[model samples]
Target: MTDDKTLGVYDEKAGDYARLMDHDTIAPTALNKFLSALPERGTVLDLGCGPGSWARYMVKAGFRVDAIDASAGMVEKASAIEGLNVWQADFSDIQDVAKYDGIWANFSLLHARRAEMPAHLARLKTALRSDGRLHLGLKEGTGEARDSLGRFYTYYTVAEIRDLLARIGLSVSDLRTGADKGLDGTVAAWFTLTAHG
Candidate 1:
């Protein structure tokens, strides 16, 4: 079942979320860096793709991009973007089986409850093509809950995230933590992993 609290937080903050992300400009650099390491012309899934910025970048890069987000408002915004296959679905509800060459989950999975992460990771694994890569960016910390903005978040320490990934059969290719100049300039932990299933 969907987490009402989490959805409520995003629903309430949808408009501000767009303004804060400024996806069109800020996403390309990271997208390019992630895409640079992938095979050309392969399918990609942009998990929690708000406003489709990363998906747009992927499409422009000549890769097919399928994207999803829990917020109807966000999905509508993303669908309006040209050349994107945007769906209003939660990551936990995704059912694609071994269909993507890359999964770019930029700043999305952190909203999931810690206990639910394994199943979500398993689903992601099932959705990837052989030798496919998965890149995820999450705020670094321990435990989970709502923030002052009423936006739900689940933070992870690097070691906790790495251990969880390994348990789900994903090999950690890269892991780093630092203050991201986004999300209101909060000191956040970020991770990038290339996993094969």
Candidate 2:
């Protein structure tokens, strides 16, 4: 589910968040894995596609892209990108059935409360065709917290992530854990997983 308080943070700081284009993307190897898993010319849905950076990246990489975010400001910024199908809606409520060949939830789903995660993940499975790919990025930790900027976040351990994916009928293909600077200048632990249903 979408958290109104967290959405408010993104809405109010959309420009600052857009500046996240500075660090911008996952590793090249991860990119190659994601592409190799998809069908040639397949469509991709970018959940919580803040600022359109990855939407632009995926389009350039040859996938058709549909990006959505709950923040109106995020939608405004992302919609400026030429040819991007940017929508203003919460990803948890996404109702498409078998519509995408890949779902890119890069650091996006973390905003949802843990209690709300399973249902939304089930939705992701419903959104994808059989064997469709999922590239997920999540903060690595055991619980939830709010950032200095007031954005709510739910973190997970690698085991928790694996279990969550498995319960949703996804088969884990690869998992990578690392650290990166957060928007607040703190070192953040993160995990990236590649899975297929």
Candidate 3:
């Protein structure tokens, strides 16, 4: 289930959030790496795609992109991207099996409760086709907390994430770690892991 308060935060500040993501240098590099691991014109899901900037990039790159976000505000923005299929849906709603060649889950699954994460990852793993790529970006820390903007997050240590993915049969192939200022105006440690099943 989606957190209502987090949805409210995104709905009210969608534009600001979009602008912040637009300038993220690290994500694009990670995106490029993720893309390189996929076949040409592969199917890709921008899961929890805030504002759909990365989805827009993938669409422009000739991938069949389906972007999903829980916030209606975000769906409105992502829908504006030509050649992109986007919708509003929570993480818990995903149930596809072997449907995508690549899933860009960057920083999106972090919104799930820690207790809910293992199940979520299992669903995502089930959603991927054989040898499909899954890119995950998550904050590096412990426990759950709401940021200043009232957006909820669940943090994980690098080892914890690696183990979680391994248990679900997704092997981490590459990783990048860094800190960046988020829309909430704080720098936090985060990591992106490129995994494949």
Candidate 4:
């Protein structure tokens, strides 16, 4: 699937997708080891913050939260919610400079085209404060494909993720791979990595 098509898919279904993802209450346990390392009350940026649920969680936790999503409809929905600084923008267009203390990409970066990832990683590194925490998640697999919903996705093994992060001067602090329960009773092999800039 192309980027345009994927963004349009999201824009068209922002409300449905937001409701579908509203169940994220606590941080997923797979992310606990990484979350434990963050300094208290620090600023966090949520990239591709689909429904802003995670951002809302961070807000309740007392951290300042900024959210960005490529889907304008998603942004509209997210911005209406209290306690979120939401922006409508693509990942590659971000220009924040040494601003966030932590960055959460979740499953969002999987939509990135492979060749575009390195540059985006570099941009993310530049956007962070020194040694800022980065939590990223991607599916464990071999190639790009569209999902049943016709959204674009790219898969990567843990090694590929590590190499890309290392190339941009980030080092993994903790990494894990396994099946995770998803919405709609689905299970998927996911790689969760916490890295530092």
Clashes of each: 2, 0, 0, 0
User: Could you give the C-alpha RMSD of every candidate to the true structure, in order shown?
Assistant: 2.4, 1.5, 0.8, 2.3
lDDT of 2 by residue, 1-197 (tens): 36788888888888988887646555456767887789987999988888887788788888899999999988999999887899888866789899999998889989898998888888998999887888888999978999887788999988887898898878887888899877767889898988786
- Whichever of 2 and 4 has more lDDT, that candidate is 2
Report clash pairs, candidate 1. Answer: 140-189, 141-156
Error of model 4, residue 166, in angstroms: 1.2
Tens digit of lDDT per residue, candidate 4, span 1-197? 13988888888888777877765533456444554577888888999998787787788778888999998888888897688899888888878889988899988899999988888888888888996888898888989987766778899988898998888888886677677654434667887788886
Ranking by TM-score: 3, 2, 4, 1
Cα-based lDDT for every prediction: 0.76, 0.85, 0.91, 0.80
The prediction achieving the highest TM-score against the true structure is: 3
User: If scored against the real structure, what TM-score would every candidate get?
Assistant: 0.87, 0.94, 0.98, 0.89
**Residue 90 displacement (Å), model 4:** 0.3
Return the top candidate by lDDT. 3
Candidate 3 clashing pairs, residues 3+ apart or interchain: none
Q: Which stretches of candidate 1 lie over 4 Å from their true place?
A: 23-27, 181-189
Better of 1 and 3 by lDDT: 3
